[model samples]
Target: MIKVLIVDDDFPVRMFLNKIIDWNKHGYELVGEAIDGREALEKIEKFKPHIVITDISMPSMNGIELIKNIREKKYGCKTIVLSCYDDFAYVKEALKHGANEYCLKNQLNDKILLKTLKETKNLIEKERVENGQYESMKDLANKCLKTLRQQFFREIINGSWKEKKDIREKIKELKLGDDLKNKIIMILEIDGFHKLKFGPHMRNRQILYNSIMNISKEILNDFNDGYVYRVTDKQFLILYSVHGEKSQLNMYKGMKEFAVRVQKNIQIYLNINMSIGISEPIYSLDRIDEYFNQCKMSLKSKFYMGDHKIILYKDIVKEISTDPIKISNREEKELIFYLRNCQYEKINYYIDLYVTGFKERNVKIEYVHNFFRRIILIINKVADEYDINPKDIYGEDTNPFRVIENMETIFDLIIWIKRNIEIVTGKLRPNDQNKFEHEVICEVIRYINCNYMKDITLVKVAEHVHMNMSYLSHLFKQQTKNNFVDYLKDVRIEKAKELMETHNKKISEIAELVGIRDRRYFSKLFKEKVGKSPAQYKKTIG
Candidate 1:
């Protein structure tokens, strides 16, 4: 409808104009009234009325001034001047300033008013067409239509539209077909799209988005009945028509097949994989929001199922385990113990267990946010114990929680947490400790050399240097390019070879002398290190 705003200083005149005509019946809407030219400009900007009616002489800016101001601002609305019999000069001035026509207040009637409005409307449309703005106006109308459709879709998905009458009216007004009543809602997410946003393709993000959106549209067009809405940068919501299908089984199968084509085409054409989550077909439009949630929840299965697969809502529902997922106090304590002790292997193992438990239990992505907080809290506790500030590991500019929030999968979350834990725990010792890294490794080596004849373990050597067993183990490997245990074995094997050359002792005696009580185990180690069993080497030496 063409919006109309009336501007007049007279209150009764404004009221009469509002009450005189059935605006909607005449394809016009009297949106608002303004006291003078100043107020009219504000209303024009706010309502964007297509036609503005104003009286000639008024305070705080006259109709002639208003017309000139409207022309100066380039407001596209047509203006009509209202004047008294004696105000022809003012009306002429108004016309000179861009007023399209004038009506005498004394001669004003519904017929004349309607006639003037119609002529003004025709003139405006004709001018727009002549200036090549007709198509632009149509585009604007279409844009508005699209916005309404998107809003309605959001309302249905959010379950906010309650009145069936309103829903039907919107459905008719928006021209969304009756087929939408029985539809499947599918949410498509570009796999690892979030990572790409700040990665190598960050500059061409719009191109990537346009490519994905275009591919989705082309593939859906092939299916003959679906609409796609970009819900976010990395996610699109699709409404597919399942209007004629009789069998629920067939409907889902068709939806799945369509989903597969979309997934495959996007991957093939764009070299980008996307995961689709298809909602169960719903017969009622109002139930759309519920199924839309199902689609989103289904997509979370990617944490376990990985990307590029079509996840059906039905499959997820059937497999939904009511068993709650959380790290038990005992499990949390165990993880903390491993972290505090700088047990890198144990820390890595427990992180995997926690993350894997999430996948195994089919935990919702929401729960994982809390799980991230829990793990970070546990790590921070160890950081506190060591007086190591978390910022030292996480960095002042980075938010660890935000990083976890952006993670695409639980596995990614675990990898991130494990890395941060390693950094934090590796810093548990004083700053000066790093200065003595070589000394620490040499001391460890000297201890092993002196004690090669006795039983030696990583724990025993860690006690000798009063360093963390895990850190010392890591340092030993970093310094000597071999692990402590392997180094100890090498030391013992070398001493045993010396004994073999200097003495005529049996293999078992030599093994016992080097702290390898298991003679067979010694022989295995000796053969591995020396490329021969002890007796074979002894005979060769002889």
Candidate 2:
């Protein structure tokens, strides 16, 4: 809506102007009214109206002085003068002070008022289009400058800006200030574009994005006073200027409103939702990229946070503790083993158990974030060991963190890990593994099925088959889909179950028969797999 404010000293005149016009029907909203130019300035600052209709002369400040003040403050508002005086000087002076139209109080009618409002609307739209649209080489260059601005910002953020001298020159050329002032970065992206009604197609997406951006700029114009850039097809970057004495919380409130406004507008007009990630206020022009990355990282908080609102980096820090964490060497080895053998389900189980452990210990959320990153790093390392490049698995320019960021569940993470491992294993050894290894694995599986109650080990099996332990270990996972110890446990657990049902043996006696030395440890593994203890399993049997 184009906000319109009216200012006139005569109460009847203000009422007459308002009652005579169907503002909404003509695409204008009457935001407020002021009795004089002095009051109008206050309203103008508060409402940030698009069109101001005011009397030429009034108490304290007059229309001419109001216009000058508006110009000094850089308000892009179209003003219209309404006056009792039809003097030539008053008309020329109002026109000279940036009034688009002058409607004399005596001559004013519905027809003239409507015509003036329409003309003002046409002028505003034309000016906006001229500022934005590409009609020629000059227009195109102007548009490219916006794109170039984003490119330079990306270069600076990505640490490519070479020298401080060059930085200052470019900032001067772009009219960017040299002083280090507090600035906040926000990254907003349409939450679920594919699910939106008019998405996927380039043309439709562009129209939707442009409409949302324009609406967002209109809402934030008075508050943020910053440049907005299209950093990615789905994401937009906003460089927010921090003004005097605004607390960080107030900034967040304003940005939260900005997000809520965008969401309301997009949903109302385009039927879409957006997620905004806001960075903490920081100083210096060069650290834009760092702030941007912080916002990007916070954007991933949406996976844990859900969608359709604003999330602050400061709050994200508060939500996730800053406690340092380190993954055990054993955990990395196990994850790599799963990735190597294509045992995706086990990989998932390992991750689930580890996370459950964290919850039990009350570990911080940042650990959860770091945990996934470490897992991905482990996957990359294993791929490297196999002489496999990750791009072949994950695709070029693939941000594994981003891929995981949107994951809503452990099951989703499992699916992602599974797919990545399958891709790498496909490229590394697409066909079935070595034939001798397959033969060795089959022999081991048969041996385990026959003598699961015996004290069994990978070495025992490898020696029984007269094979190298390492090669046999590799083959055992390839053919039977289990590492030696896991497969042995599986066999022993099944055998123990049979002993429990038919033999009526004590739990410890059954544990002994399964080649498990510790009955307590056997029950722990049993509960993990069967969801019941050996005694509990035996009690259910008739």
Per-model TM-score on C-alpha atoms: 0.52, 0.39
The TM-score obtained by model 1 is 0.52
- How does each model score on lDDT? 0.79, 0.73
Quick one: best lDDT, which candidate? 1
The residue pairs in collision within model 2 are none
Q: lDDT tens string, model 2, 242-288?
A: 76635767766776776677668767887566888888776766654
Runs of candidate 2 exceeding 4 Å displacement: 1-141, 157-159, 162-165, 178-183, 192-201, 222-224, 244-249, 267-273, 300-309, 318-350, 356-542
Per-residue lDDT of candidate 1, residues 205-320 (tens digit): 77777777788788778775777777666787888888778888887777777888888888788868798888877666655556777887788787767667789877874465
Off by over 4 Å in 1: 1-136, 158-169, 179-182, 198-204, 243-254, 268-271, 318-333, 352-357, 387-389, 428-542
